[model samples]
Target: MLTGQQYKDSLKDGRKVYFQGELIEDLETVPALAAPLNEVASGYDKYFNADPDAINPVTMAPMSAADLRDRIPVITEMDLLTNTTYQSLMTLSVAAARLEAHVPEVVPRIRAYVEQARKDDIRITECITDAKGNRSLAPSKQEDPDSYVRVVERRPDGVVIRGAKLHISAAAFGHDLMVMPTKAMKPGEEDYSIAACIPANSPGVHMTNTTYHPTGRDPRDFPVSSHRSIPDSMVIFDDVFVPAERIFLDGQTAHAAVFAHSLGLWERLGGVSFMVEQADELVGLASLIAEANGTAKISHVREKIDEMMIHATLLRAGLEAALAHANSTPEGYFYPDDMYTNVTKYQGASQFNTMVKHLHDIAGGAVVTAPSMLDFDNPELRPYLEKYMSTGSTVSGEYRTKLFHAIRDTTADSFGGWHFVTNLQSGGGLFAQRLVTRKNYDLERARALALKAAGLSGA
Candidate 1:
């Protein structure tokens, strides 16, 4: 297994990585990316340190029937799912199915990819979303056919691809890029149906990263934001070559949508898992902030906290139900129950804004207006700031303001904005989930039950 430093060293391979207008030569040395890089390293550590019972001792894969299952819960019930580990696992599952949907000749490619990834402990970023120049036109109909990643040249030994995938999480930090089509294609649009795995450092594969990083803040002031974040990037493929062994889908237009469909389900499951963690954090914050503000007994505060509990409870129930009824696909990969996963994601996302608003309302304007820790360190202003910042007699001004700063970092800052938008839009938004729920639900059974209740079963 690759150690944290070993994983970091592997990124030195000559791939072009740019952030904030400057090309980054080495990720390990960059201060701006340090936190996110550490997060990725920790994910590697988890795989190495995972208990043998929960993971395969020899292969380092999860022991669950759902291959690549998020093992955060398996190791310690306390750890939250890390993006790199969970997402790489999700991509593995998705890539496995892409080949399973293809002809028998293409099936061995996915098995080989999985074996290599597990053997090397490679991190992967699933690259799906294309630049998609025009919304109304399909890939072949668009003025720019290169809007989506496609096969530009086909050689006997390999295929050359060119395009860009946007908002790819951890693309720069990962070892492999699981390239897949974002949308389905028609019979004539075979070029857009391509799916393959390319080494992140492969020639012509470039990554330009963009992410929210809170700078120059004491860890006490921005606890969560100061650590544990992943960088999202636009991964550009400029005539990158994929060997025959790495190509899962070439021109199979009929099965083009399989990658997206499979990944969507797995991604939503990841969303649900993370929401459980978020809900727990939000609840703890609400309780502590309420106590610190001396509003613990207020009826409205009590009601809002109860509402938060309801959201958390229902989402957790959905996750459990999904696991209880998880279904296995033809490829032998297990996915959470579709209806339950969709409802969990949709409701959790729908409630996110409200949860933030409630935390802000309970904590008051201090969440946004809290003075920087720098002022607290000023010898002259420290005394005066401390005197005015305290709320209850027992609450220290430093502690109170620090809590408020943490709140701002979570709910009022750029990081908070990212959390809100990603939570709602990450799994294709609420409407997409609703569509899945409607399609998967047993509506006919419900109608039959209703007819029986109304004494019209025979009619």
Candidate 2:
């Protein structure tokens, strides 16, 4: 496995990456990209630095059944969530193994790419969403064929692809990309049914980055945003050639559908795993700010806290339920209960706005109008600001300001706004989650129960 510095140095390859209309010559040199790059690198470091007992024998990395079984925090405390990056690698690894059980035509090649990824210890960002020009139309029916990423040229040795993939997180930082069909393909949409692993800096591959972090803020003021920011990108493939061995599924529509199903299961479970931590942090912050404001004893304040706690608790339960009911594929990869995973993700996304509302209620206006960290540092304003900001006598004025700033950065500011949207849209959004839930729900059992209750014959 590569060291953190080795991972950082790997991005020096001449990939065409653009940010805010300007070309980025090197990712490590860019401030906005560097944080997430470092974040990804830390995963490699964890594997290299971990004690032998922490390692998972199957993946040859430092994650465990307990780490996942316990549903440990992934967002709030960076040090504790040791297997965050390995989870992504494992998702695709298990995906390849699972796909092998059903799609024999493509499994061999897919397995080859999976083996290479494991052997090289490649850090991969899964790229599934294509830039569809029109939502109402299918890929083949779109006004432009480029709406969906497709193979334009099939060569004896490889295939050439041209199109764009959007909302690919950590695309510019990772070593490799695992491309899959965004959705199931129809009979005529064979060209869009391609899944392959391409080097991030492969020739003709370009990326334009998007981030939520505001520039030039004191790290103390925008603590969360300033410290770690993961940027998404629109990865364009302009006649990029992919070797035959790297291609997983080429013009296989039936298999492509299975890939989407399997990818969603793994991706949603991963999202659910990480988001439980976000909920935990939010709950803690809400309770902390309420106490800092000296309103913890108020009945209404307690009720609001209860609401947030309920959301957090229910989410945790759903995650555990999914894990407890995990199903193993014939290939030996265990997947979370599909219904439970989708329900957990949907519940989390649907309640995000309400959760933020509860947070805003508990935090009050202080979340938005809190004095800047710079103001607190000013010699003249320090005492005055402290006097006005101070609450709950025991809570230091500076500490109160920091808590409010944390609230603002995470719940009310632009960075917080990004979190809101990301929560809703991440892991394929509410509609997708609902669709999966509906598909997996046990409707027949419900129908029989209802019929028996109505004094009708149970069919």
Candidate 3:
């Protein structure tokens, strides 16, 4: 495994990464991208260097239910790049299992790739959502042929792909890009059914990056996002070549959905786990702000806090349920229960906005309009601001201001906006989660119970 410094040095490869219309020659030098890059680099050093013989939980394949449960804390603390690498490997493993019975030829390639990735200890980002030309038309029916990433030429050695993937998180930083079909494909859409692992610096691959990291602001003011922000990229593949060995799926239209479904399972599981923690944090913020504001005892405020507590608890319960009912592939790889995972992800995402609203309502206008930390630095103004901003001796103006800063940084600013959208859209959105939930739900059992209650046996 590479050390932190080595990891940073690795990105010096000729990857075309753009930020704000300027092509970034070195990611480490760009302040906006540096924090996350350093974070991921440090993660590598922390996990791999701490114990060479010990298995890093980020890359460890869960073999049993206990293993799945044990990975929660690690997953929660993992950087976005590390977590996505885990998701990529797990997606491939699950997809391979699903295709083993039919497209057995691809299984070995996937397994080999997973082994090599783990051995190399490289970061990978998933590229699934395409720059689709039309929402209503299928990939083959789109007016523009490059609407979805498809195989443009099939050479004896490999295939050449052309198109773009949007909203791909950390695409510019990762070592490899896991490309797969965004949705299921039919017979005529074979060209679009291609799935492959392309190197980040591969020829013709370009990434235009965007980030939520605060620019030209006091880091203290952005407590949540100041030191941690992952860049999302519009990754364009202008006829990128993929070696045959790296192509996991090619023209296998029937099994195209397998990668997507498998990825959704792991993604939702990770999403729910993270949401459980985030929900608790939200509750803590609400409670803390209420206390700082001296409104903790108010009936309505207490009720809102109560609701927030319940939300956090339910999300935790969903995570536990998902773990307890973990499913195993034929090859003995364990993944979280789809039903519980999707339901919890859906519940958490669908209600995320309301939770934030309660937080904002409780936090009041200070969340957005709080005096800057720099204001407190001004000796002349400090006294006046403190005199008016403080509620009492216990809640100093500085303390209260810091609290407001945290609230604003997390829920009222750029990072907050990113959370609001990603919470709903990540892991394939609410509709995808709902569909998975319905598909995995035990409706037959509910029907049986209903029939028994109505005394209509075999009606």
**Clashing residue pairs for model 1:** none
TM-scores of the candidates in the order shown: 0.90, 0.91, 0.96
Per-residue lDDT tens digits of candidate 1, residues 224-334? 777856678999999999999988788989888877887775677667888877887888889888988889899999899988888889888998888878776655556
- Distance from true location, Cα of 378 in model 3, Å: 1.2
Write model 3 residue lDDT over 256-275, tens digit each, in one string: 88998888767777788889
Tens-digit lDDT string for candidate 2 (1-459): 567788678778888888888889877677787767777678667656344234323243223345445333442344212232344555555556666666666666665666666666666777888998999999999999999999999999999999999998878776777788898898988889998889989999989889877667788988888867888889999999999888878897876766666666456766787678788888999899898999999998899889989999999999999888877655455667888988998898889789889888988898888889899889999999889888847988899889988988887888888888888898788888888778878898898889999898645
| Each candidate structure's count of clashing pairs | 0, 0, 0
For TM-score, the strongest prediction is 3
Candidate lDDT values, in order:
0.78, 0.77, 0.90
Question: Sorted on TM-score, highest at the top, how do the candidates line up?
Answer: 3, 2, 1
TM-score, candidate 1, is 0.90
- Can you rank all candidates by lDDT, best first? 3, 1, 2
